[model samples]
Target: MASVVWYVCLAGLLVAVSGQIVDDCVLVGGEKKSDVDVAILAKLAPLKNKRFEAKVEEGSDTYVYTFVVCGRVITNNTSTNEGLLQTKVNSKDSSVIGRINETHVISGSDWILLSYRGGDKYDSHCGSEPRTAMIMISCTKNTLADGFMVIKEERSKSTECFYLFEMDSSVACPPEESHLSAGSILLIVFAVLVALYLIGGFVYQRFVVGAKGMEQFPNITFWQEFGNLVADGCDFVCRSRPRSADTAYRGVGDDQLAEEPEERDDHLLPM
Candidate 1:
């Protein structure tokens, strides 16, 4: 049993150390990074070609947000707007809000957040820093309506700007894992241990001890004795008749008692 458990543990350790690639969204080769559930990302894969649009009015300017998942942002409006994330369109003029620098799926406290880093920098008035985008994808059970909304643009103290967006979809939900119960695991281990014991015992008894037939079994003598004891106990308990009192105990005036006095007659006379 101990040896079987050791082998099972060793196999599990090897699998964990191999670190086979399970998903692109999962974080690897990092110390403090947590693994992002790839199921959510996989659910969003179908939306890669589908672009989500939202319009938000702030002060005097209106902003239009268009984005996709696991791919570049393509609005199909013009060739110049191929990889742009957000576009600031006002009454008279239109400008780029953010350009795609890089995109990654990162793990949040309870959900997944997609980051779109724009490479294009803004003017000196906006701190001359590249605008970034964050899309918060939340899991939803409502399959009928998928919510898509733009939260707002946040301007930080460092003059850097961020476009915040939110999405509620069923794809962001974590996948359910199929796991074996404790009883199932224990039964498997016990079966493996029994197989190993039987095989090892057969090999040793057949070759090393030169045993034949049923004697090749391990602890055959002990098993045979145990079987006999069990059979005897069953017979005693299930007997139909009981011994008579005459045979159960010797009578005080039996013929053997009379013969015993005659056999000790010499000793009685001498003593």
Candidate 2:
């Protein structure tokens, strides 16, 4: 029991002596990290104490919030000064994710917003070892078609490099990328084309195939033959009486033609 007390006292002394800035803090959870940095959260003297800039309204009354950690909430007060924060690098929690309002393409560093988890749970658990770190694998907010989303970027050490991922209320990526591709559109077009081809073939078969196997096309000879056939059929049907004279004459001529034969030239006999 005496040893436990000493250990607790020693921990308190170490925390007090370290008296560091936001960069020195350890990450607990909720935010991702990366070796490849997306932006410089601070160009100079980063992760240190500062008065809450009006541009970075971190949900505090006035310029009261302490400091900005890369992927975690602002620790309200960890320094000797009222609005000052201590630096820490081993973060356990992440910054808050806020909405991006612009429609234009946004890229490179210099992002728009900052956010993180706050409260007792974060303060107690953050900045510890074995907590490990995560990368910002993606922040797909800029890619969304709806033109609205909230996201944040953070850094973590793994594989000797940083990675990037996302955390947010909404809109980093659409539910599916299949809608963004041409596959669905191509399939619809192909189906419509096939239907048209089948319909055209059916229409051609029905309209072009007459009582004859293949209907004769509308050329000069075809029209003339068609006219003759129609006239002959009409005359035959309207005949007032049987004309045996013409019929008998035509039959006798046809029989004579059939009976007539050409004289044979016997080349073998002549030789």
Best by TM-score: 1
RMSD of each: 13.1, 23.7
Residue 142 Cα positional deviation in candidate 2, in Å, after optimal superposition:
27
TM-score for each prediction? 0.45, 0.18
Overlapping backbone residue pairs in candidate 2 total 51
What are the clashing pairs of model 1?
A: none
Task: State the displacement of the C-alpha of residue 144, model 1, in Å, after optimal TM-score superposition.
Answer: 8.6
**Candidate 1, 72: how far from true, in Å?**
3.5
**Lowest lDDT 10-mer window, candidate 2?**
98-107
The regions of model 2 sitting more than 4 angstroms off are 1-25, 28-33, 37-47, 53-108, 120-271
Cα error of candidate 1 at position 203, Å: 46
lDDT value, candidate 1, whole model: 0.59
lDDT string, candidate 1, 1-271, tens digits: 6534433454354435433322222232333332232333443554544567787787988777666554446545663322335567845434444433344465442456776555457666458777666788887755512566888767654675776778876655544556999999999999999999999999999999999999999989998999999999988899866655347565676666554444445756745
Top candidate on lDDT is: 1
